[model samples]
Target: MTAQILDGKTLAQRLKGQLQTWLAEVSPQVGRPPGLAVIWVGDNPASAAYVGQKQKSCAQVGITSFGGQFPAHTSQGELAHLIQQFNQDERVDGILVQLPLPADLDSTKLLHTITPDKDVDGLHLVNLGKLLRGEPGLQSCTPAGVMRLLGHYQIPLAGKQAVVVGRSILVGKPLGLLLLASDATVTFAHSRTPDLAGLTRQADILISAVGRQGLITPQMVKPGAVVVDVGINRTPAGLVGDVDFVGVQAVASYLTPVPGGVGAMTVAQLLLNTVQSYGQRHELVMPQFSG
Candidate 1:
């Protein structure tokens, strides 16, 4: 069977529309739009593209975008100072430092500098700890986006077998926790696994977060399983995902497309997180989204 596309692009757009409506109604009362500060270091092309999309999304959703374009040589202390300033800025509700910082920077220390209340990226130790305990808190964007996509389509998670390929703190681990919370039995497969194909073929829901392209072949997937591809790799052939999309689409019951799938949802979730932070800080009623 030809798999149904998961259509993250359409769902993300719908979510953004909902956020915009919520912000329009409340910003006048709050005396300012919800503000999000994005700290981007260096000139990494991919990071630049990611930051651009995020800021653009913020504009669409009425979150003020602050912080931009730090040079590669910018000192760690200088960046941390900015985070401190953002933490204290009453207008700002969310702050995020773009990843893969320059060689000399200490990303962990700098990330820790942002106040948990404004840590909209949800990478702070406090937020991660909250997620670990299955409590309500800010969530990591990509994983949250994946769950959102699945929920949008009304996919069943309870009592299913889910296999996530990758073990990164950012996507894989958080996603596995979310799946388990939904009562799906979760397994994490990584490069070190001796039988990746055997592990993957057991999944009712399969996800690939590894950056390597074509890591999950059609043969590795169980027929009729749901597939979510979280990897974004730039190759000479253009951007691609970890799954062999064309091949896997023919085998799986559902599949997410590379450019329009998880990537779009990630940006949408970032905006959602920013708005959630703003709503909490202001003690204002906030509309909630699934995922």
Candidate 2:
């Protein structure tokens, strides 16, 4: 069977429209628009592209954007100080430090400096702890986005076997927890996991978050299983995901495209998190979206 596309781009646009309407109604009462601060360092091309997309999305959703790009040589102390400033800024509802900071900088320390409430990226220890406890908190964008997309599509997860192919804190580990919370039996496989294809073929829901191109071949996928490709690999041909798209499209029941799938949802969820934080701060009731 030819797999149906998950079509995250359309869903993301719909979500943004919803946010715009909500902000229009609430901004007047709150006395100011929800504000998001993005602290970007260095000249990483990918990071620059992501930051631009985030700022553009913020404008669309009526969220004020703050913070600016810093040079590669910017020190850890300076970044920590800036995070503290945003934490104390009443106008700022969310603070995010673009990842892949200079190698010399301590990313964990800088991330921790942002207060838990304003940590929209949801990488702070406090937020992670909340996730570990299955409590309400800002969630890491990509994994949250994946769950949102699946929920929007009405994909079943309860009592199903789900395999997550990655181990990084950003996506794989947290995503495993989310799947578990939905009552799916979860398995995490990494580069060292022997017979990766065997593990993947048994999954009712297969997710590949490792950044390796063409990692999840059609042979590795179980027929009728749902596949979510979260990898973002930049090649000369353009952006691609971990799965072999053309091949897997014929084998799997559903699939998420690279550029338009998880990527679009991630930005949408970041905006959603910022709005949620804003609503909480103002004692406003935020409407819940599916998943």
Candidate 3:
């Protein structure tokens, strides 16, 4: 059978519809729409695209998004001050600072300064700690999006041999944690892993987050394994995922496409997180997505 394309863009559109309905229900009680603040410190094209998509998703869901753009040379102190101000702003329920900040900026310190409640990115140590402890907290959007895709497709995770490639705090580490929470036996592989393809072949659930071009080929995937490609690499051929899609599609049972799969769900989950964060802060419970 030809592998089913996990259409994240379509899924995102449906999820955004749910967000609109949820917002409509709660806006009356809250007396305002949920708000999201996105702060970008530099002019990186890719990051700008990601932030713009996020803001657009917010608008589609009827959430008020405040976009803050800062100069490339903006100091760490200035950035922290903006975060502090957002933390205190009653109108802003979620705060996101775009990643891969300027080379000289202290990303760790900047993440730590955001109030844990408003940490919509789920990068704060406290939030990460909560996830590691299997508690209910805002989860990282990309991983959360991956889970939504898996659930939508009804791919079982319990007792599965899952492998996550890459160890970045953003995608790999937290995604591994989420898989473990679902009762999957998780193994995390990095660039240093010897014979990466061999480890990949053992996975029942394979996720590639390594930011390299066509890093996962057909030979690396086991027959009928589920593959999720999370990389966003730009090349002359256009956007490419970690997995070499043409090759792996022949071998994998399920696969996510680069431009339309994980990427779309990521923004969808960001909007979900913003609404969820708003509900949590105000002691209101939003209806879970029943789709």
Q: List RMSD in Å for every model shown.
A: 1.0, 0.9, 1.0
lDDT of 2 by residue, 184-282 (tens): 999999989999999999999999999999999999999999999999999999999999999999999999998899999999999999999998999
Cα lDDT of model 1 by residue, 72-184, tens digit: 99998899899999999999999999998998999999998999888887889999999999999999999999999998899999999999999998999999999999999
Q: Which ten-residue region of model 3 has the weakest summed lDDT?
A: 282-291
* Full-model lDDT for every candidate: 0.92, 0.95, 0.91
- Which candidate, 1 or 3, has the higher TM-score? 1
Per-prediction TM-score, please? Answer: 0.98, 0.99, 0.98
**Winner by lDDT:** 2
lDDT value, residue 18 of candidate 1: 92
Residue 76, candidate 2: alpha-carbon lDDT = 88
Off by over 4 Å in 2: none
Model 1 residue 130 CA deviation (Å) reads: 0.5
Q: What TM-score does model 2 achieve against the real structure?
A: 0.99
Sort by TM-score, top down from the best: 2, 1, 3
Question: Candidate 1 — number of clashing residue pairs?
Answer: 0
Model 3 TM-score (2 dp) = 0.98
Candidate 3: segments with Cα more than 4 A from true spot: none
Would you list the clashing residue pairs of candidate 2?
none
